[model samples]
Target: MVVLFVVAASVFGLSSEGVRDAVDDVGPLAPLVFIAFSAALTVACVPGPLLAGAAGLLFGTALGTPTAIASATLGATAAALISRRFGASALDELSGRRVTALQDWIAARGFLAVLYARILPAVPYNLVNYAAGLTRVPLAVFAAATAVGCAPRAFAYVALGGSLDDLGSPEAIVAFSVLIGMALVGLLFAARDVRAARAARREG
Candidate 1:
């Protein structure tokens, strides 16, 4: 779905300026439309970073941060719920004792589990959503964790997007620096967590 959208956008010569113009033309309904579009695209596996950047490009950091956060929260919740409902049996079939233990741990600390996953650069947003669905974590807990955990990266990218046209400017440079820093921190944590998970699996 995302690939198709990208292809269509490319084929049609759709640029950020075009998207910005269209979003602006929508006037008062722009925020709602943007949220809806963001959620849908995200659920379809569109890259969250791209969407966050686009939000910044379209609405600037002040509005884009919250907009991206809200959209991502909504999208993650929607995917989790849908996967839980439709894929429960498949998930059960795939689950082993080790998987069950992990699920139990997540269930016991669902919010933190989701928060950790959301902040991990190596973990894809959609994959976390689907994986969380297989756990006993409540939707509200998952959504809350996603909102808080996603904020920093979302803000950084949005800030970068807001300053895209002036990359040499102080604000743009700062935003870019912050974005790289966030990615590095996230990647480090992600690598650590992957190692821990692997070790636990071997011990099991």
Candidate 2:
């Protein structure tokens, strides 16, 4: 693992400009090459946002958004499967009511559950990737939910990165608006849930 990371780092470099240059040098195959590296690096714990930002810098918003989404979904799916296979087994041995409850909740709600978590801004993306594997949610459902739920933010983030040098650009404006809108929506959902929970407690 360490050797692989070192090799990739040497080949791609750690800077936005460097990775962009290296991948771009691949000519027509650049997007595929970027996707491969992005997926591998993400599995190694590299932040998805960094990759998405790099995508925008490398390919602009239109191309970068889809590229980032594919890379993130592929990588996140891999990480979740890894955790499910290894981590889930270990969790199974430990056994706790809380664990069961979480697993069941995720399993029962399936796509929507994963979707809601993915849509929420404060939720950590990478953590969800690994943790989802431990639950009973089907693999296909997890991947689909991840792609759909994350698409909006992926576009917004890519646009933001692409517009770093030109914040006045239309892409930047749309990106900022989407991000803020998502944040507000997440807050509203959180408040509603809180109220519901409080009401339930009172009734109980």
Candidate 3:
């Protein structure tokens, strides 16, 4: 995680001009590097939003969106596996009730939970990945949902970043608006689930 953070910070610090220069200089390698950095960032718990935005700024829509999705999915899967192997007990100890509720919810709707969590920005990406690891959700299901769920946001970021020529352009504003709407919808569903779980627990 520490290593991941360092890599992410370095990537995030690149100036827009620097990013464009690097892309021009390195050409094809830029997407590969961006993907690698994005994976590391996700593992380090760097915010997904930052990564998505950076992908756009660095690679543009054509390459950035796919790179972000692939990197994020891989990073998330790796994090989930590692958390399950080494940090499950610790996580359970720290977030017992919430974890239990999440576990139950995942069991009931494993794919949907993964999809919703990925789609929404309400919960940190790392937390959701780790939580899924602690649950009994199938790996294939988790991976598939994660890949699909991350697409919209990833594309949005790439689109926003690609439109940098006109910083305040209608395209950028529309993309940002769409991202916010998706995030809000995800949060609403998550909140409803949490509330239902709490109510059930109280009733029981």
Candidate 4:
């Protein structure tokens, strides 16, 4: 993993401009290629933020946001399904009353739980996918929540990517500010929800 990160960093340079230049060399098919790569990377536990930024740098906000969202959703869902299939034995071994109750709660509020998880940066995207798979949350609910929850953050990253060349401009400043605000608000809400859930669990 360390070697892979070093290699990727060396090749990609960890900047929107570098990614843009790399994508531009591919011409018209860049979007498709980037989206494909984003999906693959998500499964490999690569952070979605970088891919979102790359999409923005490669395609700009208008095209980039939707592309990033779609690619991310697809990748997360794929990971969940794969984990469900392959990790069933391990999951079965861990099953118990508390686990069943938690699963029931998540299954009942799957969309909201997932939405909050995605909205808050606390939940790592790859980890969330595998976690959801371990529960009984419906795939459709998981997909929907992930799509909705991931949009704001994805947009923020895309915007940042789109504004990379003009970071000093008002557009870039606004984009950065918006992303920060949304992240904070999401974090606050997620914390509140977690507290409430814990209280309820204790009472039960």
Task: Please give each candidate's TM-score.
Answer: 0.81, 0.86, 0.75, 0.82
lDDT for each residue of candidate 3 in 59-178, tens digit (9 for 90 to 100): 777777898888888888888888788877776788768778877878789888788778776667788887788887887788889999888877877667666555477767777787
**Candidate 1 has what TM-score?**
0.81
- Candidate 2 residue lDDT tens string, 86-181: 888889789799889888977999999999889787888888999899888999999999999889888887876666556678888898798889
lDDT of 1: 0.81
Range of the 10 consecutive residues with the lowest summed lDDT in candidate 1: 1-10
Per-residue alpha-carbon lDDT of model 1 for 1-204, expressed as tens digits?
223434544676655566678778879778778899999997898888788877877887788889989998999899998889988778779989998888888899989889988776667788998888888999999999999999887887676666665557776677667767877888888778789999999999
Best by lDDT: 2
Which tens-of-lDDT digit does each residue in 120-156 have in candidate 4?
Answer: 7666778998888887788888999999988887887
Please count the clashing residue pairs in each candidate, in the order shown: 0, 0, 0, 0
Least accurate 10 contiguous residues by lDDT in model 3: 1-10
- How displaced is residue 105 in candidate 1, in Å? 0.8
| Whole-model Cα lDDT of every candidate shown, in order | 0.81, 0.81, 0.76, 0.79
Question: Which structure among the candidates has the greatest TM-score?
Answer: 2
Deviation from native of the Cα of residue 170 in model 3, angstroms: 3.2
Q: Residue 31 error for model 3, in Å? A: 1.4
Rank by lDDT (best first)? 2, 1, 4, 3
Better of 3 and 4 by TM-score: 4
